[model samples]
Target: MTGWWCASRVPKWARAPIPRWRNWWPRGGSQGVRSSQDYVRKAGAAARMMLVNAAAARWKVPATECTVERGVITHGPSRRRLRYGEVAAEAARLQPPQDIPLRDPKDWKIAGKSMHRLDIPDKVMGRPVFGVDVALPGMLHASIAQCPVFGGKLKSVDASVAEKMRGVKKVVREGDFVAVVADSWWRADQALQKLRIEWDAGANGNVSSETIAAMLRDGLADPKLPQARKVGPNIPRPTSTTPPWSRRPARPG
Candidate 1:
């Protein structure tokens, strides 16, 4: 087994039917399952090989003669069988085999098939825990208000009304944003809505898509614009040309 495989014998106090994988690499979205499936499959194969070897040693037979299915190892000649849990302790002590061959895609029972997600049951039952569900003793919640326009600054705020609201602890103002802190998120949000705030939109107050496009076009036309990479002596620099689509003016709405 590679370092990726962290399988070990379950302690007496925490004995469970299934083996647990620990120390997962941090991943987000679908990439977690997509990127790690091969590693997971290989780790599982290595762990299975260890269990088969353990069963073989116990039955005094060659490991090759043992067959495994669903968590059971069987010896065809002697008709001996052992559950994964039965040999887990011994298997945990054995060194994992390397480069275990993956099963043929034709023999796959689960992969590339539509199967129910393990987490769906908990989610459907409203038993799943999310980040927002976490609560700590004496924890406070906050709601923030930011400028609606780009390049805007907080000019002034009259937070007297919000500060006096029930459960509102504090009304804080920073350079470009304001926030209300309270015992609960709802209280903070409600208090935040009551605050009277003024903003300075600065020079960008009247900026529009047309102005932004003009700025981009001006930047692109600058000869002094920094080059991200230098061209090699043998390489020729391509002539710059504006795309036909960008040359067209925006249509009036």
Candidate 2:
């Protein structure tokens, strides 16, 4: 749910046989599933509805007559119902359909332009659950220190002092990437400051903003420089030496 760490090795829970179902569940809470349509939030509510339908099937009730509302599965005519969670044990015994029938969009209660968003309440309350909000027991925090320049590599790293710092768990180094793991994020940051790292200057070692501006000026003056998708004929760019205010007024011909 937090990335791919909790994925089932054997995927496809809905199509899997009764015994082989991997008990798939999503841990992203409400905000993790980013569907603009508010139907399915986390565990594919449609599939969960199907599980309710599967349970109602055992009672010889037609699925068309059966309706699921807020995890409660209700049968028609008799109005007999059971919470979906109550029938989960029984649903596990029954195999899912080979071809699951989709609910008609017109009949869907939640599918409409006027349908209200589900997360608006949580967002207003400032408690909207997101992937970054995930916190588990015994979870470790990691912070990475990357090279300043792109495509740059670390020439050398001295992390001996960082290792001895408070709450510093471990220091990992791979190519230009260096990470500090610790008991807390702030402690790891403190440890990072203790370490001294040297980076290998790449091709742009001597390059600066001034050098780039010069290159642009040189390219503008080149008559052979191919014109890109321009709207009109190319005009010479203003030179650094010729300020607009300092230019002499043009004399009449």
Per-model lDDT: 0.76, 0.63
Q: On a 0 to 1 TM-score scale, where does candidate 1 land against the true structure?
A: 0.59
**Could you tell me the C-alpha RMSD of candidate 1 in Å?**
10.0
lDDT of 1 by residue, 114-200 (tens): 766567778788886666787899999999999887779999999999999999999889888999999999999999999999998
Question: Model 2: per-residue lDDT, tens digit, 124-213?
Answer: 997965655667898777778988776788888899999998888999897877889998878888888888998886876677667777
TM-score result, candidate 2: 0.49
CA lDDT of 152 in candidate 1?
90
Whole-model lDDT, model 1: 0.76
Candidate 1 runs further than 4 Å off: 1-40, 54-96, 150-152, 202-206, 220-253
Model 2 pairs in collision? none
TM-score of every candidate: 0.59, 0.49
